[model samples]
Structure formats: C-alpha cells, structure tokens
Target: MGDTFSSLLELGGPVVLILLVISIAALAVILAKVFQFASARVGRHGLVRQAVTQWRTGERNTAAQNLIKDRSLSAALVRNAMDAIQMLDQQPLSSQERDIREERLREEISARAADRLFALASWLKALDLVTQIAPLLGLFGTVLGMIDTFQTLQESGAAANPATLAGGIWVALLTTACGLAVAIPVSVAVTWFETRLEKERAALEVLLTGVFTAGSSSTVAST
Candidate 1:
C-alpha cells in the first residue's frame, strides 16, 4: 500500500497529493450523505396518505399526533399542515378568509419541505467543485512535468539522455491520469446523489399535495 502511494507521489507530485486529499473528502461526504438518507427513512411511504384519510374523518388532532410522532419527511409535512388546520379551526374567520389561510398554510408547508431538502443537499456543491476541478488540476500537473522535461533537455544540450526525457514525459502524463481517476467517480457519485434527492422531492410534493387536497375535501364536506 505504502509503495503504491509513494509511486503515485513520485509520478504526480504535489498535484496528485492534493487530488488524493480531495478524493478522500468527497468520499466522506458521499458516505455521510448515504447514512443521513438512510437514517432519515426517506423511503418510508403511506404516512401522508394515511394521515389524510384520518384528517378527512374528523380525527384531525389524532392524525396530527400520529404523524408528529413519526420521523419521515412526509409525516413532518403533514403534521405541519395539521397544526395549521387546528389553529385555523379555532378562529371565527369567514369562508373567504379561511381559504386564504389554507393557501398560506399550503405555501408554508411547501417551504418547510424545501428547507429540509436544502439541508440534505447542502454539501453537494463541494463535491461538484471537486468533480469539475480534478481534471484541470491534472492538466496543470502535466504542464509542470513537461516544463521539467524541457528544462532538463535545455541544460543538457545535444547530449540530453533519451531515457531521462522519457521518464519526465511519463511522470508528466501521470498527473492527468490521477486527475481523471479522482474526477470520474466523484462525478458519478454527485449525479447519483442528485437523482436520489430529486426522487425524494417529487415524492414529497405528491404527498403534501395529497394532504392539502384531502383537507380541502374535508372542509367542503363539513359545510
């Protein structure tokens, strides 16, 4: 293991070292996000639908209690909407005013959902930066190696060793290889993460919209 790293260091120099550190950091973020998503139980389904059914049955507080005790994102959003319903139910507002309150409540619920999504996606930009710059850094290393090779040839004049020139060229190319190595996997990871986040967002939107529609139906039935 040590020999392998040492060979990389010699071939790629400082740029390789920097790229390796960035690779490690990116991996950490990826793993941490995976764990976070797992812990969040984002995959849990049906909480919102069940809560909506209960809400429509005039068990509003009970529905809210059940959802509030859950940890999933869908549950959290439904719970917020339920809380708004409970508070609004206590007031003496007219029908038009009540409609306005529900509209605002819908916006508030969506905003909270977006905030949670943003938190999940926060460190992703750093991964994107690493993905973009890794190749450029590698190219920079290539340039540095070529410069050293030419400098050696210039100093040696006509007697420049062919083997020495070849070695310099090889080392110079190593940087580009290392850079691509660092970049490709990180880029793939970033894409996968974004895909998963989008799926979650889409699911949340469907669930929240369903809850809102259910609440509206309940209000219509009561009058």
Candidate 2:
C-alpha cells in the first residue's frame, strides 16, 4: 500500500497531492450530506399526503402540530404556513389584512426553505470543483512530465534508454488516471445529491401549495 502511494505521489507530483486533499474533502462532504439526509429522513410523498389531508379537513393546527413533531424540510415548511395562519387568526384582522399576512407567511416559509436547502447544497459545489479541477490538474502534471521527459531525451541523445522513456510516459499518463479516479466518484455523488435535493424541493413546493390552498380545494392529492 505504502509503495503504491509513493509511486502515485512521484508520478503525479503536486497535482496528485492536491487531488488527494480534494478527494478527502469531497468524501467528508458526501458523508456529512448523507448523514444529514438520513437523520432528517426528508421524504415528501407520505408526509405531504398526510398533512394535506388534515389541511383539507380543516384540521390545520393539528396537521401542523403532527408534522412539526417530526424533523424534516417538508414538515418545517408546512408548520411555518400553519403557524402563520394561527397567528393571523388571533389578530382579528380584516380579510385584506389576513390575506397580506398569509402572503407574508408564505414568503417567510419559502425563505426558510431556501435557506435550509441552500445549506444542504452548499458543499456540493466544492465537490463539483474538485471533480472539474482534478482532471485539469492531472493533465497539467502530464504535460509537465512529458516536458521533463523530452528535456531529458534532448540532453541524453544517444545515451537515452528506452526503459527510461517508457517510464516517463507512463508516469505522465498516471496523473490523468489519478484525476479521473478522483473525479468520477465525486461526480456520481454530486449527481445523486442533486437528484435528492430536487426531490425535496418538489415535495416542499407541493406541500406549500396544498397549505396555501387547503381552503379552496376539496381534495388534496399527493404527488
């Protein structure tokens, strides 16, 4: 293991070291995100169905209470809207005033959802940067290695060994391989995270819409 690592370090040079660090960081982010999602259990379908049903039945506060009991993004959004309605109900405001309050509450819920989702997604960009740059760095190392090999050949002329030339070419090519190694998995992780995030956003939107229109709609269907 040690020999293989030493060989990689020698072949890829500083670019390999940089990629190594980025790989570690990407791994950390992936793990953190995985844990966050796992702990939150942020599923949209079931919770939205349950909450929307209660909302349509005019059990708004009860729905909010049930959802808020669980810690998830969709629940938080529904809770925010429901809590807003409760607060407005207590104010004895006119119809226009109540509408304005509901709108403001909706905005607040959206902002909070955005903030939470952004936090969840923020580290993904770093992983993406690693995925993008690692290959470029590897290519850079390859170019440097090739340049060194040519320089060595020019200086040595007839004395240059075939084995030495072959070694240099392989070493140069190693960086590209290393870059791809680091990039591929991170890219996969980024894609998976993006898929999960999009699902969460869709769920939140559906739930929020249900909450906002619970009064007008007779049936709240789950998506």
Candidate 3:
C-alpha cells in the first residue's frame, strides 16, 4: 500500500501531494466534529424536552436539576432561561418592569445560543473550501501534465510512440480522479454537518419558546 501511494504521488506530482495534505486536514476536522457532536449530544433532545415540560408545570428546581448534568446546547439554554425566570420571580418589580426584564433575558439567552451554534459550526468553512478547490486543483494538475506530455510528443517528432502517448494521457488524468475522490466525500460530510446544525437550531428555538410560554402561563394562572 505504501509503495502504491508513493507511485501515485510520483505520477500525480505536487497536486496529488497537496490533495493528500488537504484530505488529512479534512479528516482530522471531521473526526473532531464527530467527537464534539457526540459529547454535546447534539440531537438528543428527549432529556431537554422532559426538562422543559418540568419547567412548564412549575417545577422550577426539578427542571433545573434534570439538566444539571446535561451538556447539550438546548439543555444549557433552557436551563439559563429557567434560572433567569426564577430569579425574576423573586425580584419585587412592577408588571412593566418584569416584562422588560424578561424580554432582555430572552434576548440574552438567544444570543448565547447563537454563539454556541457558531462554535459548533467552526472549521466547517475549511471543509467547504476543500470541497470546492480539490477538484480544481486536480484539474490543474491534469492540465499541466497534459501540456508536458504534448510537448514531449512534439519533441519526439516522427519517432513519437502511440504507447508512450497513451501512458502519458493516463498519468495526466490521475490528478482529476484524485481530486474527485477527495471532494465527493468531503461534500457529503459538509452536507451532513450542516443538516444537523439546522436541526439543532430549530430545536433550541422550540425549547426556549416552550420555557418562556410555560412560565408566562403559570404566572397568569397564579395571579
């Protein structure tokens, strides 16, 4: 395998080498993102929903406790909202003041959520760049190789051999193949990561909305 890879690098030249480096970097990023998503439990929303339900039913402490060990973005934001509302309840404020404070708290939590999502999205742009440029790099390599091959053939004049020309063409095409190989998988990974991010964003909005609405209803009922 090592020999085969070395031979490919020789044939593909610098373009292939650059692609190899990019593929390694892209793989590292993908692995790190996978670990991050797993540790943060990105799509695991059952616990978050249960906590929100607890909060909605006026079990503030229970809701907070349910999320004590949870590290998902949704859970964290919901917890923040719960804490803010609980603190607001303890404050001696007029109705207007309370409403203003609650609005500010909501905005703060939303901003924090946006920051978390942005963190989750970090390094994704690098992956996107790889997907976009890998193919072009490969094409660039092929074009360069083809130009060299034709120049050699022109030099050979009447002695130019068909077998040699065929060999050169294949060698010239290798870079394009390698470029597509790197790009196709990276594109798939980018799509998957983006889709998950979108889902998480939607989930965060829904969970936070649930917390605020539930608190308002409970307050209304009590008054």
Per-model RMSD to reference: 2.6, 3.5, 1.5
Query: Once superposed on the true structure, which residue ranges of model 3 sit more than 4 Å away at CA?
Result: 216-223
Model 3 worst lDDT window (10 residues): 214-223
RMSD from true fold, candidate 2: 3.5
Displacement of residue 160 (Cα, Å) in model 1 is 3.2
Per-residue alpha-carbon lDDT of model 3 for 26-136, expressed as tens digits? 999999999988877899999989998777777778889989898887888888898889889888888899899999999999999999999999999999999999999
Local error of candidate 1 at 81, Å? 1.0
Cα-based lDDT at residue 108, candidate 3: 95
lDDT of each: 0.84, 0.81, 0.91
Q: Write the per-residue lDDT of candidate 1 for residues 1-223, one digit (tens) a residue.
A: 9998898897788999999898899899989988888766676767667877777777667778888768887787778877877787778888899889899989988898899989889899999999899999999999999999999999999999999999899889999998899899989988988988898899888777766666543464585
> Model 1 compared with the native: what TM-score?
0.86
lDDT by residue for model 2 over 74-154, one digit each (tens)? Answer: 776777777776676667677787778778878988899898889888788888898899899889989999999989988
Q: Assess every candidate by TM-score.
A: 0.86, 0.89, 0.95
